[model samples]
Target: MNETQSYLTEVHCLECGHSMPYRPDLDFCEACNAAWLDARYDYSRAADLWRPGLPGRHVSLWRYRALLPPVPEEFRISMGEGNTPLIRATKLQASLGHPAIFIKDERQMPTNSFKDRQGSLAISVLKQRGVTECVLASTGNAAVAYAAYAACADIKLWVFLTSLVPPEKMREVALYGAEVVKVTGTYDEAKKIAANFARRRNLHLDRGAKAIAGKESMKTLAFEIAEQLARAQGNHTPWQAPDWYIQAVSGGIGPLGVLKGFTELYEMGLTDRIPKIGVIQTSGCAPMVRAMALDREQAEPVIPQSRIVVLSTGDPGLAYTLLYRAQKENGGAMLSVTDEEAFAAMRWLARTQGISVEPATAVAFAGLRKLVAGGTIRNEETVVVNCSGHTFPVEKHIMDDQMVLDMKLSQQAKSKEQGLTEALRRLEEQITSVLVIDDNPLDRLLVKRVLQSNKPYRVFEAGSGPEGLEVAETRAPDLIILDLNMPDMDGFTVLDRLKANPDTAAIPVVVVSAKELTPNEKSRLTGKIASIWQKGAFSANTLLQHLVKTIQTGTPSTAGSDVINALQTLDRSIHKIVIVDDTPADIRRLRRFLEARRKYQIFEANSGQEGLAVIKAQRPDLIILDLSMPDMDGLEVLDTIKLEPDLRRIPIIILSGEELSAEQWQRLDDETTDILPKEEITPETLASHVDRKLS
Candidate 1:
């Protein structure tokens, strides 16, 4: 069979069996519109009509052209999205008593999700059909994935999401440059509005299962898993399918496609038995699970609130279709899991297997646990759980909680000897002196001693704001320690005076008192006070915790083979780091390194073309550059770097290794490349320059 005849001959309604010609712009079954249509194929005229022979084809889902709808190859956008790894669960097997347990890690895909698999295909088809602008209604991963691929394809995308969507996912969608609309109601409501807008605008509606291409894209997971199983058995054993294929069914396209893939393999005589597909749903939104249990023909819509951000679907059309087809084709059933159960399952997977899964993915394992405990699933059955998202959210919350606890625990761990040692260390390190302005001498002394021991601090006594500023001007201390209560001028007055004074404006301040500051007070203090510590509420340990966090946040790590490291180090001291280089590779390497660190805030400019403009906007602390760069040379950057009065104090570290003559060395000494290097770089050398300049 020629490639032209592959993919589809027609689209047939599942309910009425009425066939219609394939159209890229078609959203649903033209006749029924009620039932989702399945793509029909002329099986007799297929090319290389064998399943096992497919290993030679492309690794993506598009490899199955015999099953997907026709779309131009040029329009297909991919980031190597398919062929995910199938991981074995040895620990889960031992505990759950399942002889063989595995997980399909979909997080490995582009955008860290399997959603890309469907998004790439859907957007590709949309582009092919001449749809320039489109709208999507999703609360979580789908929104993120769709927005990104749409951007990649240069298609205008409008995404509608409810306020219930997670803030992080919302930021992701926005970051992808998609126009986002936040609705006050549930995702279903937003979806309804999106549908109406699509109809009014004559825009294309792209659901995971709306097009054959999207659905067929998911088949890559099944084919990959099948090949993996065959390889695992040493090619001697006949390839056997999974006993239980467990996956979370929200829109249900993923699970349904798996069954379709199995049917395809069976038609090719690759397998004789179909896997028992278990449809898992969250208890808060178990429309399909409820329908299946009652043996209803269809599901009624219900707003779900357990996790409105992720599982925000009110309708379960796809889930109902899965239940109807998978249950009938293979002996299977639906299971529902509560939010609590889902969380527990997710945590278990993370702790035991080190696989951090999204709550939706966790629902599948939760269902499997229910089935196992209830003796519904046999111990011998092989189970596969599809882990949908990365475990970053759960881990972030866990880290935040631990940080809070560390502050509390450090108080218990504090000792007088440790305090004295810290005080001596601070004194030797020449950390800036701070004045404690309070009427109570005892409270002042206690805070003084705490800071002196735990941080680089010097204690100064002040009866009021006037006295504090008087000492601050005379001593020009690097920081101020203040109390809200004072005899003459309160700590707030001292803070205001210190900040108003140009000489001491940059000095950091710490508020020390027994009073609990309100949110308004904290906001008012702003840059003047680094933090507020309650007299008894914050111990030396808590101060240390704050210091460590501040330090980690303040300083960029000098690690990596990137040009941005030097600039990033400077950025921590201030707002930005500037690198003036000519080579794209040097700029790219540095930017990538700095971006990866997260600790270092770095920005770059390749030439002198807009070097000064970028510097003005970024306001960098230090500039590291090659002496020669296109449009702007090192001398030009150096001259411009020091020309601005606001940028005069900022240092320049020339990162060049070209062999220099005596004249060149003399020129470097007089100009910005004062710390010029002629050999390879090292962290210690860079650190020395940063410390010498910033300290």
Candidate 2:
């Protein structure tokens, strides 16, 4: 086969099957109205083109040249990408009791990502056509890959990136001689800017997945994984497909190509079966997962909420439709893991398997664990997870202390200088709304002063957990600098409530406790907050530095919050119980009984009106309500709460002084609501009923 030769046939839309002859200028589906167009190959000549002289080749992605996108020999530049190791995760498999688990460590690729494959083909083809200038936008990895290849191809390239991207990533692109323009907006905004730049310069635009080279080059991963698995069994045995093939997704180009590769191989008598394609996503930006869960054919855009900025592609565009259909047909799961889980998995992989993966890769590992635990992936089945790249180190030295130029999108701002100043003023107004949740007056005042002295922060104080939650919603602060030792409600419980509420989950949190955290407390805080300071032990400067980092990066504080805020604070994995009654004796009795029986975090409201307020604030797992109240009746409270879509899911337990009401019984849910007579109820009876309802 010729080195630059390929069996390339056409470019077609994955959505509308709109086809055209292979053209370098082709990007979207054009008249077809889709965001992705993939390369098609003449499969009749596939065996001769793909299966020739396998024993001795370049040992890089170009080894299978005829199977890749075509470019002239002189333009086919490569830094020895591909040939990444597929290691058996023995410890991980054993820990989870799985038969076979493999990690396709794509971190070994030239630019330390699977993206190198895309760049090798994409940039080569562009270089062959004498393209001198290009532009693209990326969260991180793709920008680095494209920049490196463009540099090698001697093509000038410009990369637009979101401010949430790590400095390390920006520096990586800059080191490859690409002009890096950091935008203070979402990834989608960055793409628009890059597109505008490309149009103005008449430059080639490669918006990552929008290029056919991605589909063509990424298929090589599927090919290599098949070949490697067979060779590992020793005697050049037949390539066998694993039961599950998994990858962490952003724009979702990798899986599209991978699924294409396996399908072609199976048709061409290479592999026996197609693997179930699994795409993992961060919970903060899981449009695909959300769509699949609702059985939707297309994905809806989500606000980029997670701190893992690298995997922060909120809109997958038409790629979601393609992936969704493939997943539905192939019998796979699209799952999302929390930022906390992803970081924890990153740590786990490093400690147990000696694998240092970025939080994006960690999302895949976490999803694999979730699948295994959920029985979606059986232990007896084989699994292969793509460890896409090295973790985001977030080192300051990489950029030499140079922050990105904060791109302003406001139409009112004219000049760059005025725009930046206005942006900073607006950001200051938002970030300075720091909420200090501490019981100690002196400590709260000290923290308020420390924060204000540095940035003139407008601080709000809350002496208890409930007060803090109320203030958190009302003030809507950018960061919560809190102490853990509150007497009214422990700061931990407050942390749980803050996280559980969608209104506050995206807010960054920092711990500034006078008391040193215990092992249990440390474990709880590890992936939740950016860092915990021993209040007076650390210098104010150090605290501010950590605060700035923890508070998230973007145009405004709301663009997304700090990396340590990547910790995303605490999750409400524990159940909360709320007691509502006008009678103090009944409220105290029930609270005491539940507190002694189980360690459920209990909150109380003296009347029905106060109870409704408590439920809205707390979002408790279970509610104990007294039917008769002076302010509002229990049934009315139930009706009001049930009307709210967000609060309707919470279970309620009603305590009535007397019973014999069929109409009231008809209004309540059998599964979520249970009634009991106060005169007849006992601790044991209440415990049994509560346990059953909770179960």
Candidate 3:
């Protein structure tokens, strides 16, 4: 039997279920334009290929090559990418009160990330296909891994990356001899350029999530986990899957592949049931988390702004589709953690479990902590957190002097008080109270779960307006997210009651409703509500931003001075300004004017779509929009911005060539700060409007 005979039985489209022959160019489904493909095999026969006591001395992922998409023996690439340590986190478990906790430390892999697993297979597949060159866009780890593996295969690799990527990462990728191109924009922008470059040069492209070989390679993590768990439990009986599988995700290919591995194991009668997967992401770039909260099938792309570079994928390609299905099929949820929380988790893991991880990996631990604190994960269940990467060249970016000092202060306090109890107290101190008033149980749960990801909020639910008011008065919540369609006292009544009460009046209220608001209702709630969100259109990320802002601005008088100080420290003092225009001369002039101010950080976007991405990433205080633009016009952009609860607060100054009609004036007046005709505007006039709005 040759390697070709042992190859995957077939490949099928994940979307349209269309079957096709394996080829590098056949990545997406022809029938449905879907980007994800599933490499299938005769599971019964594949299972027979593996036997007990196998993988004896094999330290690499090739131990499971029988199940993976086959490459010829001579073409295979291996660098000990698998068999990562699965350490029992006993001390961390004691702190969190979980019965059993394990860390699948993938940092031990070559290239110091799980991406090495993907690269090993991806580059091998490329080698098998006789491809000599390839192009890809990466945040950091993938570029390094692919470049390193490609170098070994003697393949020419062109790597495109965002300028914001850490200098150390860029140096490392370039060191691998790959031609690295740094784009002066966001990760999504870099990806677009890379895709175009690949097309123009006719180079093989490694589409992370869309690549079957890369996706299949991730299965090794799951396989190793299952096998190790069995060994740990004496290997007497069939392996039992962990109760929860947690990992920090960007493209979500890792989780998808892990889930597929569990499914295969179940089919082979090796595992009883698949674990509930927890997808963790940084709050700054969390489309997958937002989509899951909204119960959407696809994630809407947003500009990536996460400081954790490896997890800063603005568009996760086809991973969103696979993730949506995985969440629906399994009892799991997506969650997000702030950079602060992730840094704190990194410190905590190092102190408590002796595990050092990058911010991207630390995010999973942060999510796990939140889940345990929120009672989403039971104390008795066994859990595994995939520590996917470590901080090396970017160690300085993980924690600064202030963060280290804070950690030391915390440690000193822990020594004085009950260790675990003191830590839990500190964790609880960070939580803000949120009250959700909705008649529907599902709605309440949905919002509650969404807010759970933010990790700094304790959610209190009320089924009716009266109950809501009672909870708000009793709890004196930092924020109230109200739904307007409740029977016997709608959100309007509840808002009125809450505003009338002195105790709860100061608390910010965000009204969420499925029904359209009348003009009178809008006017009535204008000053009373902090923001109005339509139920179906509400986004978790947007809601979280509002919540964070509310917490920062509306610190309770009862809160301790220490708590107040901590909240204040979380605020970013710098103001961000974004300019969206196709005209380079106009953009240049505005940038020069803005830069002269000395206090503003300016971001430029050449198109409305790019502008939207910038807004999503930076959450700029102000925006300058050109009326006429290609792809998405200024009006369309304005409409889109107005619809977002977070972006709507930003002041927009419209630049138009033609004079506006009364309708246009009214529309602009309703949504924008001011509109300036191109002929009438000067730097001084623009600065005046900007100053007033910013002030």
Candidate 4:
């Protein structure tokens, strides 16, 4: 490498602080057993070389060549990834009662997302290393970006993705000539599969945040924001960081990289302060938000339920070690928004500001609204929200539902007879039809009640799989809620038959089952089923809310809209409860008792680790723990829970088989809601204690 190319001095492990030579294949630090690595630069020399008025005609990220990973100019791959517009959101600011609000419109970047910045740098670096093939796992946008950039660099790319990814995204990725593997599980699972594939093939794996080049490119966003803000203020300062920098995160690499950029500016005396960063996530699958709320250093993995596909990273690799510390040190806060709030914000932006964004991007705006309303953000502070990407081919999934609702409401408001007739015709043509296929009458009735409570839809019932198939063929319903435990035919057989027929294959199917699906059953439903709802894991209102959104968005796999309205209309409140015990009998007893009331959304875990993960993911209102487990006893779990400020507030009841001594009782008393003997735990007494504590 030449002198300028040698700007990258070394790569270091963020966890163990061990440094090593920069290599394309070295992803993890062996010394520390850490997956995250940071690229160190000769910043002293970089500061001297980079000045306010450096001569450069290029406006792309390469403008700061001294700071980015070194690559020969001839080998660099650039598609105008940086220097995107920074628009002042005057209307949004006025509406939110904030003084200054600006939008860093990353949607303007090539490939229509911030991923382009990383892709451009990453692909260029790989090319320099003479790497011919690479693989990665992405929800959507990143795949498209990498496919495009890698193709430009004449490199072979393999992409692994979950089946939940939108059809449009898959088409886009395939169109770029990249080999795609559609995994039959969540994004986290897809990542694992991709890692295994890379290992077996000995191919270069694009390790997202764990790769130095991947995160290094994202710092340009921060650099651009500072420079643009300074220019907007008519100031000649080299940098001007915002009072607050907000962005929605999945892996959290973007925000961490941006923070690093600001830190670089501060070291160079170009900026005075590091902006207080704000991270946003969907409430449905927000491990980072949960960790933040609990005041924990690490975020536990979750099975993500968010419909915002790009933000559904169940495990944010390196976030706890890198991004969490950045947030804490910078005096930042994390916030979460529901699908309803994000959709509302999406609609508001489109109507008022004429900015159409995907749900993931709108999440940041929703967070901004929440912060303003909660007084977490002052009115006078200058804030910048990252408008990361726009919704296009996926636009139908984001806007069509609201459009349909708006059209119906508009037609109803018209006074003309022609308009009324037209509205009636539209309703008749577009009315959603649902089919409930279950052997149990109670289950069918429950499905009907939930679907009907939200909006008017024609509901059809089938007592068996054969009858359900016949009705499905005849009625051509928009959706089907299938139960696995049928008398004559199981749900898997029904699903397979439906998929075999071209006529019925297009319709979406939601699996609602009480029985735990076997591996074979799960495999059969992988890409076939749109969603799976455990029978007692959700309340009727929650089901209704989800169904409405799924119908509206035309994405059966996505989470539903806000349930605040549904909650208001429901007769009884439903609270989530998690039971942690090694005994299956104990778990079944609690579940049986809780299910009888139909007021608790219950989850179960056999080990303390599993229980902790579930608690972090679900944020249950109450926890029931068995004190004497084989590994990681209840007391240890209780101590871990109590350490988290947010989780400590959740009431926990301990059920111990052994009688505790005076000191043990006192120690337990200080942290737990109550400790009752397992032998004394009757259904009635347990129910009473639960009701009182929850109340």
Against the true structure, what is every candidate's RMSD? 21.6, 25.5, 24.7, 23.1
For model 3, residues 1-695, the per-residue Cα lDDT tens digits are 34345547778887789887766446777678677788888777766655453545756887787778877778887776889988889999888988788988888888888889999999998988889999988888888899889999989888877777776777677666676666656677667667766876577777887778877988888888888887776767535578789999987888988888888888887778788899999999999999889998878898877788778887775688777887788788789999999999999999998888888899999999999889888878778888866525634333221111011113444443344344334334333578889999999898887777767356777889998887777556788888988889988888888899899899988767787767687666755765566676646665565556556555211111112111112235546678889997887777777756745656667798988887787677888899899889888899999899988989988999887878877778764567888877677887898888788
Error of 2 at 304 (Å): 0.7
TM-score of each: 0.55, 0.58, 0.56, 0.56
Candidates ranked, most accurate by TM-score first? 2, 4, 3, 1
For model 3, the stretches where C-alpha displacement exceeds 4 angstroms are 1-7, 23-34, 51-55, 391-695
lDDT (0-100) at residue 131 of candidate 4? 92
Choose 1 or 4, whichever is better by lDDT: 4
1-695: candidate 4 lDDT, tens digit per residue: 24345477888998789998877556789687687889888887777666564454547888877778778787789988899988999889778878789999989987899999998999998998899899989988889899889989988888887777776776666556666666556788678767766876788889898788878888888889988899887777756888889999898878888888888887877788888888999998799999878888888999999889889898885675576787767787799999899999999988878888988899999998998889888887788899976524634333222111111323344554454344434334334778899999998998998887766576778889998998787557788888998989999899999889888998888888887766666667766766677787777876775576556544431222222222111223567788899997788777777767757666677888878887886677899999888888898899899899989889988888987888778768864477778888777888988987797
Give the per-residue lDDT of model 2 (tens digit) for 1-695.
Answer: 55567888887886688888877657678767665777877776876544532666447887666667677677887899998998999989877788789999999888888988988888988887788888888988988898899998988877888988877788777767676777787887677667766775577888566677878788888888888877765535446677889998988889888888888777777777788988999999999999999999979998799898888888898888878888777788899999999999999988888898888999999999999989999877889999976734546654432223345566677874465456545433433477888888888888777776766455777777788898787557788877888888887888888888998987878777766566687677654564566666666665665565445431011011121211212335546778899997787678667756634656677788878877886677888989988889899999898899998878888899987478987887556788888987788888887887677
Better by TM-score, candidate 2 or 1: 2
Q: Write the per-residue lDDT of candidate 1 for residues 1-695, one digit (tens) a residue.
A: 45533547788776677889988777677777754767777654443464435546456766666767777678777777777778888888777877777887888877767777788888888888878888887767877788788988988777777767665666567556665556556667667656665665677766656557667677666766766666664564334567778888777777777778776766656766677888888888888888888787688887786772476576867557656766876888688888999999989988988888878788888888888778777887767777778523423322221111000112232773454344323323432455566778887777666665755444567666786787676555555667887767777777888888897777666666766556666556754555566666544655544433333333222211222222223223344567666675675555555444444455555577555655666566666677766676777666666667888667777767577778767766753345546355455565566445544
**Model 1 regions lying over 4 Å from their true place:** 1-5, 32-35, 44-48, 236-240, 391-695
Count clashes in each candidate, considering only residues at least 3 apart in sequence or on different chains: 3, 6, 0, 0
lDDT of 3 at 580: 89
The most accurate candidate by lDDT is: 4
- Give the 10-residue window scoring lowest on summed lDDT in candidate 2: 554-563
lDDT of predicted model 4:
0.78
